[model samples]
Target chain A: EDQVTQSPEALRLQEGESSSLNCSYTVSGLRGLFWYRQDPGKGPEFLFTLYSAGEEKEKERLKATLTKKESFLHITAPKPEDSATYLCAVQAGAGANSKLTFGKGITLSVRP
Target chain B: EAGVTQFPSHSVIEKGQTVTLRCDPISGHDNLYWYRRVMGKEIKFLLHFVKESKQDESGMPNNRFLAERTGGTYSTLKVQPAELEDSGVYFCASSRSSNQPQHFGDGTRLSIL
Candidate 1:
């Protein structure tokens, strides 16, 4: 079964602090890796999709980078509004209906 | 776009009761998916629908759960005789295509006592 594991289950940072969250995975064949941000009592919002190793995507203060075995979500100069749960999911195989295997997620709390 | 929307933001019931959750995907989206997140656990896929067809349902836990996407516009998931373990947040998502990033609904929180 495809599996995704995220490190540092919970993180606390001061406003403007920078840090990175890690997601390690094992799959038969990788089709795509996705990053999502979820707020309390809300659904997850799309962030980035990294398809291959050495690929990276950036949005505002968030930058997502992918390697063969893992992915990283780097947050730079984060603000209190950036506080949310970061989810990492992997889609295995090239099939059109492939489902995503998600990690437990990392909860981030940025203090102002 | 309105994004994916789900009804009954929250529900509470005793085990063995029946509950039905509804979802309306983004207009024109052909792909719809169902997922659940148990407390302290990762979000897990339950099923997928492509234009009213069951594209994949490998993640469904058991026969007690049934899902349907009639007319390819809206979908519903019904859990009969729900167990206490079924307590969790059920989310619905949709995308333009399989390769596109899916947009999610706020989710229906179901608590089975």
Candidate 2:
């Protein structure tokens, strides 16, 4: 069975603090890994997509890195406005119909 | 271009009742997807449509659920005889291509009494 697990169900950091959230998975094949940020009462906003191990993508203060079995979303000097639930999802097949399997997500709180 | 949009941001109905949720995908997007998340659970895929055709629906729970994308545009999901376990957040997403990242809507919160 394909499954995705996000570690540290919740994380709190000071305004300038930096940390990383982990997402581990077990899938038949890794087509792509997606990262999203969801604010309260809103849908998830697309962040990054990593297709291979050792790949990294960055946007503003957030950076996403991928590995064979896991992915990490690293936040640098996060601000309060950056607080949101971070979700990690994986596509299991290389085909067009590949379904997405998502993790429970990690809730982040950045205190200013 | 607008993002995916879902209607009836929240729906409350009694068990055994029928509820319909709608989703309008981004303009020119050919791939639309439906997902649901129950309390304390990760979001689960329900179905996928590509240009009014059902590409995959293996994640659909049962026969009571039906999804349609009319005219290769907006889509609708109808749940008949809703059960208590059916209460959850239903999200709609769309993408231009299979390999592209999906954009999501605000989602509809369904409650079955």
lDDT of each: 0.95, 0.94
Flag regions of model 1 displaced more than 4 Å.
none
Candidate 1 lDDT tens digits, A10-112? 9999999999999999998899999999999999999999999999999999999999999999999999999999999999976675688999999999999
lDDT: worst 10-residue window of model 2 chain A: A91-100
lDDT of 2 by residue, A1-112 (tens): 8899999999999999999999999988898999999998789899999999999999999999999999999999999999899999999865666678999999999999
What RMSD, rounded to one decimal, does every model reach? 0.8, 0.8
Please compute the TM-score of chain B alone for each predicted structure, in the order given.
0.99, 0.99
Poorest lDDT segment (10 consecutive residues) of candidate 1 chain A? A92-101
TM-score for predicted model 2 compared with the true structure:
0.98
Q: In model 2, how large is the Cα lDDT of residue A33? A: 95
Residue A97, model 2: Cα distance from true site in angstroms: 2.4
TM-score of chain B of 2: 0.99
Q: List each candidate's DockQ score.
A: 0.85, 0.85
lDDT of 1 by residue, B1-113 (tens): 68889999999999999999999999999999999999988999999999999999999999999999989999999999899999999999999999888889999999999
